[model samples]
Target: MKPTGTLPLRAGLGLKPEHYQNALDAAEKAAGGGLWFEVHPENYMIDGGPRLAWLDAIAERYPLSLHGVGLSLGGPEKPDEAHLARLKKLVDRYNPASVSEHVAWSRLGSTYFADLLPPPPTRQTLQTLGDHIARTQDYLGRQILVENPALYLSLQGDISMVQLYVEAAQMAGAGLLFDLNNIYVCAHNVGGSTQDWLEAVPADQVGEIHLAGYTAQDREGDEVLIDSHGAPISGAVWALYESFITDAGPKPTLIERDENIPPFDELMKEAGQANTIMDSVARDRQYG
Candidate 1:
């Protein structure tokens, strides 16, 4: 299936309860045409409530994207049909510009973990994930993007994560949601060349980009980077984002801050910075 709709190649923020009114007001004022908002469908998988009501109002004025965190697409079994049905309801109601999910599993035999647990990137796991993605798309009747997860420990996979993601997209007819912060954290923890990994990603397969913050701590005298998304975007992550846009051109980028919630203006400041970098890339491509 062809791409349904493309997100404006600009900056967006994850919708938070604290910023609901701010988002609604910005949308009403038409503050920025490229400014968009993303929400986890898992949060809105309900029949009716204030949250859904607020989402209904915000989505009317801004292009929305659904970034799912609980599908557990890479689990041992196929995606849950009941979960898919609920997700489908939200998709049909919202008609979001894009939909995406992580490349990790959080469910195991009816037990659901709060965290997105990384799956071993082995050939067998790849096949399982690809099949699950294919089934998910078939059920939703829309193409979805698969995001790379943060890696803290090495798994028994001969192939690199970039190759696994690219192959999964090809096998399932999906796109990639490249998260620069995750790449940085994973590289710091796993001991690899981040630049080499970035270069290995298929440019055409990337449909969206994610930028977030991470925390570093010393563990047993070894520094480990955590993909916390609870702070501002770090300078190094911003630099990597610029490098990615320089190579891949501009894709829909999002600033995700899930903790330590800040004022709406602060989030907008980060989004504005992303827009600036993307605008610069566009200018260079146009004139150079």
Candidate 2:
């Protein structure tokens, strides 16, 4: 199997169309050298258009990463052939430094859901997920990173959710795109310790890390953490990120914001914060 693409150990933001010009401008400035950008491949799976043109221009400036949300990698059926074809085209064209998808599935039969639905964690599901991830990697001719899904409810399984995630990636010779925010949300929504996820996942196998924000809602009398990528990174999640980075060193980290979009500079600021932690880690390693 082809090796997964490599990304600079730097911070990236989820590219938004509104920030295209800013991104291009930043790329030219010395300040943007450490910045990279990731996009949902589903947005650029097109023939030709102004959007594709913008992406082309951006690709020329900074290293790119494709974070896909529609692969349904954990779904029952095989990945859609047509989607893979379109994705492969973009992969070949841009040669993104990384390509990743969530462990959740969003499709069933001919119907599709707009949300990243969590899959049950059973041995059968593990086998299915491993097969799906392997097939996805084989078809794309490149290894891909599979992210853990955000959980809202607990389900019975022979193995723990974290185990399923890490083992499946190992089984398929793929990497893990550990989303720290998701784990934080899971700990609140279901019931577990984020440390369990941090310890369960092998740091060397982590190709990338995602740091996003979640919202809390008062459902009935209790509060729940929602993986709503619409707020600033919380102090708790930031602490979690720092703890992990201190031990694991740095990986290609991303600041993801998909709703209530903020100014480009604001997103860049968050990226800078992540860069700071990574920078600290780099400094420690150098001195030690």
lDDT of 2 by residue, 168-220 (tens): 88899999999999999999888989999999989999999998999889989
For model 1, residues 1-288, the per-residue Cα lDDT tens digits are: 546338888999999999999998887787867888999999999899899999999888888999999889878988988999999999999999999999999998878897988888888888998998899999999999999889998877877777777788789999999999999998889878679668888877888899999988889998888898898999999999999899889888999999898999999999999999989999999999
As a TM-score, model 2 comes out at 0.98
Residue 26 displacement in candidate 1 (angstroms): 1.1
Note the residue pairs that clash in candidate 1: none
Clashing pairs in 2: none
Those runs of model 2 whose alpha carbons end farther than 4 Å from true positions after fitting are: none
TM-score for each candidate, following the candidate numbering = 0.97, 0.98
TM-score of model number 1: 0.97
**What global local distance difference test value does model 1 have?**
0.89
* Model 1 per-residue lDDT at 111: 89
